[model samples]
Target: MAVAIVRNVRPWGGAAADVVIDGTRIREVRPASPAAAGTDGESVDGRGLLALPGFVNAHAHVDKSWWGRPWVPYGGEPTTQGRIAHERAERGPLGLPSVDGATAVLREFLRHGTTATRTHVDVDLGVGLRGIEVVREAVDRLDGAVDVEIVAFPQDGVMRRPGVLDLLDAAAAAGAASIGGLDPAGIDRDPVAQLDGLFAIAERRGVGLDIHLHDRGELGAFQFELIIDRTLRAGLQGRVTISHGFALGELPEPRRLELLDRFAEAGISWATVAPPATAPLPWREMAARGIGIGLGTDGIRDLWSPFGDGDMLGIALGFARLHGARTDGDLTAAVALASAQASPFVHRDLHDLAAGAPADLVLLDAENVPDALVRGPRRALVIAGGRVVARDGDVLL
Candidate 1:
């Protein structure tokens, strides 16, 4: 097997070491031997670079985002239903989000060192599978540069969209990896039926589940508990993820503790974009409870808001600052949540850095992991599956 070495890089801000890559796996990591640095193997001079595992975007709307499109102002109604209508209205005259647009967004993510993602593509009555098709094309185009998990998301209410359930199943058969749901209680208005339909589709399709929960306070808490119950009953413990679980912040201390325990018991995972408008989740507490917590950019510079720069580094910084995490330990934990914590919920091989880990690594121009999280430095190099896919903000492969 051909061998490649990244010499003199500080792995997670530790002492300098050499990472030996054999094909798609990291074969070895050892203290740097300057004398043998250039002896054999294909070498990458990693002096002054901090090597960390590539970021994993646990939740993102790959199809709904207007990343490469001409900047359009947020023209949707403030209400969720109105916004869904507005999104539907635009898809026709504007046409489905193009393959080029989706590819551009993926490239932007690569520039910021995100090597893997779980992208939510809309699968509803309005657009059917057009968005999923184009986004899947983009994902296929960037196959090795970034590994993406396709979530057949129902941006519109699943139960309200009649026949959307079959569409979701078709999306899975066509290539989607997971089934997605939106607001079983708030939007669907039939929590039990919505949960049943979602779980049933997931069961029938033989895929995982990712539900978007924007419902808040008591109702949100109820929906969350119900979903967890279904997950356990379906025996899909670690296979289920709740995105934008804002309800977790609304519960009282005692109730929150109970739910946290339940979440851990059911092996539930939560994905958050750390939006400023909502109550920030007690991330540290949930993490301690052994609940899987992952971070995302939600929607990029899309129609929802004029935020999101496709920078996972910046997102991590925002996460740390949002929670007032100033200590090195706290900041380090935030970084891990944004990157490695996603492994259990997504794919472990793609998000971890170990001897047998996939060669999905980011070399950033930072002295240490904490500094990278705080400063959000530019990526020096990005390697995906042992291939140099990007460098200095440019996509190479």
Candidate 2:
């Protein structure tokens, strides 16, 4: 029964209040009380800070991020296939002796106010379950500091590599929270079979689906339909997620509206790394339609591109800047894309800094929500599970 009090903080950049925590759950949220000063629990002074629900990163690749390694110029890849080839050629040989790289990035994520993330660990014929094993090990090591949802990601198309399903099954059995897939039409060349295989595994294993659907335009819409049909049939609805469904945003206005209706109906969600594109994602429309859309860093300084620093605040700002969000309302919504808006998609019981909720939160040196969004201030304190895990940009846990 460890008790703690976060005093004088503006929750969601609102009016100042004191959040009282009893062990792992928030006990109370009320105006500053003079009596709280004499309470026996630990007290974290939050003056001049804006408190927010800890950000949730819905899509990530933690196992093989080339984040801490020496810089390697991205090998030129004219097409998606070329990029796949370059990635396999470059990443296959990066031996894994320790979980140092992944741990380092997870620490950085905590320092930047992200307390939980869903990381896709590669599961393919080449690497088998080695990547998943190392990532799980890291998760175990950092259990209390950051919560991680492991996705057994078939980065090298499931059907393209024989016996990959068996490896994925093994990884899931070993404790992967979900199963993942690459581009069905573009990489596997068989959207129906690939989706069937992915959904079949998810159903059989009693897990969830987080497919990487990067196919563009009409082809992407075709794949999305197939996914929706399968999700509806299997009754997986809210349990299914489509990462990087960028093509849906590229469709004509009428078509996009129709499909968005279908997405809301099926309860399917979308996760984006907030990549800059010629045609922007219809995030505002999606939000209006009650669709669940979350943000992620995708690959943190990985072979894909030389970007990402595990800073969700910086990425939230990117989401705002990319979408031309200048008004206060727009900026607040952008920040929520990485926080409350994203958390429920991953786990319905998570997010929000309310009583009875887990005390997973961040206190930033900002006056309000809009200020936090525009400036991307450093975290003054990051509390996960009612414990101060990181303070002043240093990971105490």
Best lDDT among the predictions, by candidate number = 2
lDDT of 1 by residue, 157-218 (tens): 88887999899889888878899999988898998998999899888778989999988899
Model 1: residue 254 alpha-carbon error in angstroms: 0.3
TM-score of 2: 0.95
Could you give candidate 2's per-residue lDDT for residues 1-397 as a string of tens digits?
Answer: 2348888888987888899888888988998766544424488777747899988888888876766667768776856678667778877565532387788778888899998889988888777888877776777787756888889998878898989888888877777889998899999999888899888888888888999988899999999899999999998878899998889878999999999999888888888887776357888788888888888988776667677889887778887887889998989888888988887555747578888877888998887888887778888888988887888998876
Give the poorly placed runs of model 2, Cα more than 4 Å off.
1-3, 35-41, 76-78, 96-98
RMSD of model 1, in Å? 2.0
Model 1 scores worst on lDDT over the 10 consecutive residues at 33-42
95, model 1: CA deviation in Å?
2.4
Model 2 pairs in collision: none
Q: After superposition, how far is residue 282 of candidate 1 from its true place, in Å?
A: 1.9
- lDDT against the true structure, per candidate, is 0.82, 0.82
Candidate 1, overall lDDT? Answer: 0.82
